[model samples]
Target: MKNVKARYLFLAATGIAMVACREPATGKEHPPSHHAASITPAKAHNVALYQFAGTPPAMAALIQKGIMTKLKVAVQLMQGQPLPAMSFYKPRNRYIADSLLVYLRGQRPAACEKIIGLTTRDISTRKGEIENWGVLGLGSCPGTACVISSFRGGKGKVSESIFNRRMITLALHELGHTYGLPHCPDPVCLMIDAKGKMNLDEGESYCAKCKNKLLAQGVVTK
Candidate 1:
């Protein structure tokens, strides 16, 4: 268990999915390479954690602690809110991570650098253009918001610590997107393509190159 600094690792679909999307894992999403990694420090960022209707209080508390301890940024626990009565849910009953992201951005709090919506319900996003994939989460480059689902992580018979690590990994990966970090070339980095919820368990928080990118983008301190 290395304290990965971050790249995304693709899943091989080898084992039983505790909660998985329908999309196949592809390991080719990252950029070619960054010859000169930026070390120019940007100003500090403010991250807001929002709890959806079904988020478990105990789990949310642990995630908040992990964000503050690991990322070292200003982490604020915002007031709990409910999803608007809309079509964010698909036929499979999983919520749409992209739809939630749109809502969060349109109504983002003032001065919030980035915001992550955590929920107990399962979430998914688009795979190609119209097809849906049962993703653990999703976000955008230099975007204002992202969403993560704990229901997928809590599906299996795992310990509390492993579950917490999964949430933290998902959090940092989406946060990386907000800093404009693409997937990393490092096979074992946190920035690698996340295929399934279990895909996150295999990589370090960040690989050397991805860590540099996070540093360059000011997501991680040098």
Candidate 2:
């Protein structure tokens, strides 16, 4: 009787341990390694950028550099009019990308025509002629166009290792949506959704197939 009782107790302990170690059904319990593709980059007339006053200067600079670099490359590939100059604005408070657009329409109607607001809000809109892109800091978008926000530490906290590899890729990805590009099938491409948790190094600058698509859309020429 003692041996049988001991065996039963051991089995019960093993069952408890298994249950404790089991993975969560909801997936949010663990960090995600991959993100789906949300949007693609094409071409546009002008892209107006809005940043909150609290945003670090370094982050603003990174956004400008990454966006311009990609735009330049897209221009080289396509024959659309050169991207209009990008400008920055200071808002009263952190605004959602869509809300910013509406506010700009009331405040600066002319400026709003070319404006694109960047925020950390979790956005669910698709990319198109009139749609704006949002990129939340370190988050993913279920659909095209996300609201991207910065990490809490400020620009200084974003190291080159983080910016070049992660932030820049995200900028390019969101910008792609503005130009009417859809998510890419390639998991490692910058156009991939990445669910906002991708390692920057895992993205591609531009794939040939994507390039061709841009050309077809009149976003690129050659």
Task: Give the 10-residue window scoring lowest on summed lDDT in candidate 2.
Answer: 14-23
Q: Look at candidate 1 and tell me the lDDT of residue 50.
A: 86
lDDT of 1 at 158: 87
Over 4 Å off in model 2, which ranges?
1-44, 73-114, 119-146, 152-158, 217-222
What stretches of model 1 exceed 4 Å from their correct place?
Answer: 1-42
lDDT by residue (tens digit), candidate 1, 1-222: 111101112222332111111222376574655743564334555778888776778777777877766574777787667875563675888776767777776655665677888887777765555456787777756566777887777656788778889888888888766666677767788878764437778774777776775666555666
Cα-lDDT of candidate 1: 0.67
Worst 10 residues of 1 by lDDT: 1-10
Please, what is the TM-score per model?
0.75, 0.48
Look at candidate 2 and tell me the lDDT of residue 194. 48
- Candidate 2 lDDT over 117-168, as tens digits, reads 3433233222344233333431122112223455422346667566545666
